[model samples]
Target: MKKTFDLVFFLLLFALVTACSPTKFATEMAIDALTGAGSSTAFTGESDPELAAQSLPFALKMYEALLVDHPDHPALLSAAGEGFVSYANAFCQLPASMESSWEKQRHMLQRAASLYLRGRDYALRALETRHDGCIRLLNEKRYDEALENCSKEDVSDLYWAAAGWFGAISAEGFNMRRMAEAPTAYALLVRALSLDEGFNYGALHELAIAVLPALPEAMRYRPNVAPADDPVRTWEADYYHGLGIDPISDPYRAAYHHFERSLKLGEEGLVSPFVAYAEAVCVPQQDYEGFRAMLEKGLAVDMETRPDSRLVNTLQAEKARWLLAHAEDFFVVIPDEQSEE
Candidate 1:
């Protein structure tokens, strides 16, 4: 009788434990599987851009569904946020920019902005998991205080959030609310850079190069030019000094510094830095020659060499070609041999 009672007790205890926590165990297992190395490789390793774009929405939705079960899962939140940002850029924003019809372009850009904000929210939530009151601080406009909570481990969240925010700002035109929030996004990016300047091979620098040019003048760094022979002066020092502006800043100097840094970090493997510098820097200056040279350089990058980044490289190459073809639309003065003669 005693032996039988002991066995019954053990069985009852095991059943109670399993019945009470099975859902938790299952959710944990799903999260682990979703975040495993093989999961990301399956997507990044895909060679076909169209196929990847078609399938990505489903994958993003699946991530959202998983987040429903694991609301505070930082990895899931970050992955989902990054997915939305990537989808918005590759599918919506790029296509919109190339759309010929004004109405279609505007509509697509609006949709892209909405998607970017969704991604930004998810990334912010992920940051909240790591630093509980950071979101509250951000809302209160205490941006620096909120960012202080972040550490090196939070760099990915910071980067994705800032990227999405900037994308939304650019996509939505001059919407006051987003424009107001630009400082917060800038703070997030700057904090991420401080924590890890080399993260993702200077992705932060690339982003800075693209967005700094568009920021409001008040938000820019406009320190007085340092002495010509200052031993501690960096490259930006020389650039600003050459511009011959005292107590003034050419936003382009900041953009160019990062442009150079990104190229050095990305080297030959990445194509976007070239395209970004061309569009953001050269086009504005109407330097058609510089623009053509940069796009051609980007086009020459062989995507097959970096199989993991093939999709991005392929997309950027397409953009470079399109920009080259549309060069007439961007420049007011296109020099020809006849004109030179």
Candidate 2:
């Protein structure tokens, strides 16, 4: 199936090149052929990380090249958006996290942020194509106005745009301008969730575990600041109302709720929920045992059981193993041998 699709794609490309000028029908056919279901499944379902890492750059560049001709092509735009985010996460951000060299890590994170924003722009452009003036409203900070017209069909664009935007913000770390835009990403995700809570096997919920926890940092909440003077508090009061949780007293509750939902929806076939929960929830709460247990569960996952998710599952498992190996770096107190006995 994959070979047949590739052959057809190249034939289309050959036609486009050999002709005096590329016809619209040929270009459209090429776009569809390149971004077809077979291509997506073949790449995603591969188990080899090294192969994926090496191949993804080429694939991503191809998507970009194709986009120059077909700017408004939905499939190409979605592929670009989703591919860049996955590439940044699995290749850039994850590697940066594991790096010991501060300068190298910083450089890698910056690269990740750039890629994430690029992905976000592609996804947002796709959304704009679907709903004109939405991006303009978003830029003007009229989030509610921007998202008002978004419906269920827009969930993929919404999710990828928000994911890439949020990923960029997280990678950049505490830039006030980017931090200010966090609410916009949150609004996008919230809208996506409202439209389809079950999108991508509860991926919306998995993302909430990270995004909700970062609200405090994103808002720049200072413990010394008075409630009346604190923008973070006010923002939380307004935003948290819809999510059904108090950020001031317990910001992690919503994250936990989402974590449970994600785990249930994803089932034992997936490793991401465990890994996300451990890093996002356990580390902050200083639940060392919980952290260890979660990583163990992730590591124990059989990749063969879900061949389509093998690539992602492997990456998540690698992260889980790394976290466990570096557990001492996060925790101040270690239990002695006698205590364990």
RMSD per model, one decimal? 9.4, 4.2
Candidate 2 lDDT over 1-341, as tens digits, reads 56645665575567658975456776666666667766666667878889989978877887787788778887888889988988998899988999999999999999999999999998998888888898898886565567777788889888999899989998999787888787678767877877787887788988888877767643534335566864434544554567677644575897887887887777667888889888888888888988888889888877776777888898888889889889999887756648789
Steric clash pairs (candidate 1): none
Which ranges of candidate 2 are over 4 A from the true structure?
Answer: 12-25, 217-248, 337-339
The lDDT for every candidate, in the order shown, is 0.77, 0.80
Candidate 2: the clashing residue pairs are none
Best by TM-score: 2
Best by lDDT: 2
lDDT of 1 by residue, 1-341 (tens): 23432443354355468775335655565556666555665556677889888978866876787787678889999988888988899889988988999999999999999999999999999999988898898776565568765688999889999999999999999798778787678767777876777787778988987887767544432224333532212222333455453222466777777777787776667789899989888988889988999999888887776677778888888889999889999999888947778
Which RMSD does model 1 reach against the true structure?
Answer: 9.4
